[model samples]
Target: MGAPVIGAALELLRSPRATAALTTTGAGLVAIAFTLQQVIGWPGYLAALIVLTLLLVASLIARRDEIDWHWAILPISLLAYLGWAGLSLLWSEYQRVTLISFSYLVLVTFVGVFIGLSRDTIQVIRSFGDVLRAVLLVSLVLEVLSGIIFDAPLAVLNIHGELAEGGPISGLVSTRNQLGLLAAIAVVTFAIEWRTRSVTRYVAIPSLALAAGTIAFTRSPVVGMVTVVLLLAGAALYGIRRLPEERRQFAQYAILAALALFAVLAWVFRAPIIALFNATGELEFRLKLWQRVLDFVPVHWLEGWGWIGIWNSASPPYSGLTPTGGRPHDSALNAVVDLWLQVGAVGVFLFLAVVGLAFVRSWLLAGRRRSVVHTWPALVLVALITVSVAESSILTEFGWLLFVICAVKASAELSWRSALSPRPERPEPLPHE
Candidate 1:
């Protein structure tokens, strides 16, 4: 390109407004791309991903000097996991499937890393807050049009979504469970924005109310329970921080002990709980699925089938009940199982280390700062981990995108350069505007 054109492009990329707009737009596009594909076709979805990747890369190039690349080594876990996933192409049942999926995942991963490389934690929170605000609102409008206004759900890509018992709503995503999960995440994001005073109460309160309303409409029991638990945990975090510095460690240990005990109790009484929620039959089906997966792991104990290709019905195990379990598999319904099945047991271990370290690092940062904005990264990681229990939230789509952002940001904060030249102590009640 000519100098004049190149200079114009650089100028646009370097603008602060452009940075903010790109972050917001990229997040919005990723979240809505699946729905758009369902509506229009695959082209729109691919176009959105391409545009998002281009914008993020251009923005990263514009700010190359400011970012501390030496510290980039801290996120090696993430890169390593992706590298292994990509390497699976060598032995995959179908190279084309793995190549396409791995390429897309790699692009999304870079977009997330660049997002963190360009902006600090608070800036990311603000960008996501803005993006999610619009998402929840749009979902609400769509749900009303489909279930209440038109009384006809939009079915695309073989996804059935609409009103269920209790007049539950699914909105644009076309699944009550997914809608419920998204709305709960919105509630968390909005709550953080409110606590941090990043947005005015007039805006935050109503947005939160809308999100809560949508969650109720979806009536996803698992989502509802998880939200309640997360809220309690957030409150506990605040309470723990209120202790004297010397007593804080003791308080944390006590809290962990209590949580462990509670978990054990829940596990022992799981049968009753499932029954209470009218989910025992569903639990039985999932148990069978889990058994089948366990039975097949020994076949490819170490290297796995292929990171991305194994999920397709065209692949061996999943293809018409060819042996390694039965057909009609749509997701392990668990992130751990999904990874274990695709990339093997070692892949699962690496995945845990990467994400686990990120969450712990972010949690430490949040405790030190005790700022609402800082707390968001840790909480976002928590949401990802919790939701992964029943959904492949941390492995694909927007969930995976958010996971990369959190992992990269937290890793950046723990870098050697960061320790040597720490960010200035945050001002009390840091200004958001």
Candidate 2:
């Protein structure tokens, strides 16, 4: 009786509805990690992660026989990147920290892999859409309560409640930039949800408005830039998707050329553009910090000091790099630079290959696939890559999770191994509840 009960429990956990719920819950928790840490503290956060990790493992075990197994084949670029990060433990100056940090990275990666393996592309989008809608709603409610109802800060959650002031509300994400990033991603997700007819207009319109309002209030220059890029990317994708197959190749080349030209023009007028966005002060500060970070690069230009995903102000080298009289910088504030600092130049190459390949594959799919849902991964990658210019969020936490999911999903579609092997018939996507 006991054995049968245990078997039934596993079977239930592996059911489609159960997997969708678990995936959404995991996404929401990781998305609001800063809030969780602030509200429940690190001990609670760690406990939540452990519990979620255990559930994920059990779900995977229960579905093992049903899984294609071949779907587990990851891209070489992704494997190389992970291998390099793990190998850093051998020479990492801070081995213990590296081990712990790498473990955390693996933990999140496992969740991403589970979701990618368990769900189809549309299901993944639906999972994100459902969680993000709730997250944005709650964030707006808190902002209104703190900014208007009470006119006070939610210090515990780091919400400044600045909605009444017409700017810079952190919501539950802790920082304006972070909140803006989430809002920007929300906008993409909501737009796709509307286009796919996944949600009724009644739900989709309000969600879009909520995301736009959040982005506006956050007043983040980084997100402002990302929003512009997203618009252009969406437009480009729309055009490409409408083109004939033969013309699409040419259109892609034209778009690439235009982007290259735009980059050059942007750099030439960067100062004026920075002033327009009122980000001059922010740019100056980042410049100074980046110069300081680069100064240490030569010491370990090849292998890096070690892989500590988030900087530890208490640790060596990092301790020395803290800004004078300012709070310790949690990250290098740039993903490429962070990669160079933590894992070295070789690591940067591998990191780029992972994202670069994923983006290319996703982009091509978006152009060629008939469904609008294919565009989500490509657009999300655009946001991630754009934000990475000024934020190192992509190296850890929610950013890493999203990255892994997109990479895995894209890989599953275009993987050379899959092409070489006898492909199994894919399971029908579970009906959306």
Candidate 3:
């Protein structure tokens, strides 16, 4: 009886016209809602998790046609080692804690690959961005309303200088830094779309404004935001310098537009914007954190205490949140530290090789001047790598989807016509021989 309901529900979700983009965005919203529910002391997060998990399962089953050999192999290889490390050290004091931490990584990696590589992933991501943009816009509007209708608390957005500390206006996201990172990536996505003229300048302009709005609400977006701009600008400059004389004008115009856009962003968020530059404490903390991580190398030079030991060893058992015996300050750096700590030299080598190959491929593909055909996904992949430095997106659903799409796009480019063409009939070859 219970099984029938589950089957019907899955069927409905997996239907052809169901739209994975909507499904993806729904998952994000549910996750956000879940986080907020926790802050508000509600039990909604569990429900949201259940719903999103079911949706993901249904979406996969419906879109089973998209699966490939590499999709399963890569993530499985990474997680298997992580699992083995965790299980091997289960007798240790940190066993339970280590399992939790490894679970987080496994979830992120699996979803990241799935979403990053799916056939319509780019489209799904674009849709997800649109929904996120709308949510941010509404939040901004509410901030204005709350300011006018209510008072000081909602009016003045508190900018938490530290990435670890997080900001005040973050809606449902667990960290202010994570929310800010998302906003920054949203801007990068729109910036690329706008530069390519796939989306109207009107849409892109407001999207930038929305990004600025999100940044104003959360101060830490600047680091990721600035890095994204510089990277894209550098790529554009490289592209333009290599362009023929005729195409140079368009590049020139694009350069000018980028300048104008940044000028506007800087002007609008001038106060909080400058604060990002002024925060010495935050900068000092990151420096100290990195140094501490380096110090651990001599001690845990070989196989680490195990997968979860870094956090479990801490007093409160929360990595950055606890501020005790945790591995590192940043999520991205934590991955690096964990790799070195848990798997030793071999794991580190494998990790670097995988990331390096993906990046090199994305760079070569994105840098192509002849076609818009290949450059879009390549550019997105490049952005993913850059953003991965600040956030663990590459280890999550978003990263997986981005990687998968690029892989599929590349595979699609193969010359099928040659393979499909009928072979010429053999005539008197046997007789001649």
Candidate number with greatest lDDT: 2
Off by over 4 Å in 2: 257-280, 323-328, 422-433
By lDDT rank, best first, the candidates go 2, 1, 3
Model 3 residue 417 CA deviation (Å) reads: 20
Candidate 3 residue lDDT tens string, 298-405: 555555545553244252223434354432332323456545555555556655555544544444444433433244555555555555444444443344445544
TM-score of each: 0.89, 0.93, 0.64
Q: How high is the CA lDDT of each candidate model?
A: 0.73, 0.85, 0.51
Highest TM-score against the true fold, candidate: 2
Compose the digit string of candidate 2's lDDT tens values, residues 154-188.
Answer: 98887777889886887777777888888888898
- How many residue pairs collide in each prediction? 0, 0, 14
Higher-lDDT candidate among 1 and 3?
1
* lDDT (Cα, tens digit) per residue for candidate 1, span 255-355: 66776698799779988876776553545665566677767678887888787722566766656333355323456767888788788978898999898
Residue 142 displacement in candidate 3 (angstroms): 5.6
Candidate no. 1 TM-score: 0.89
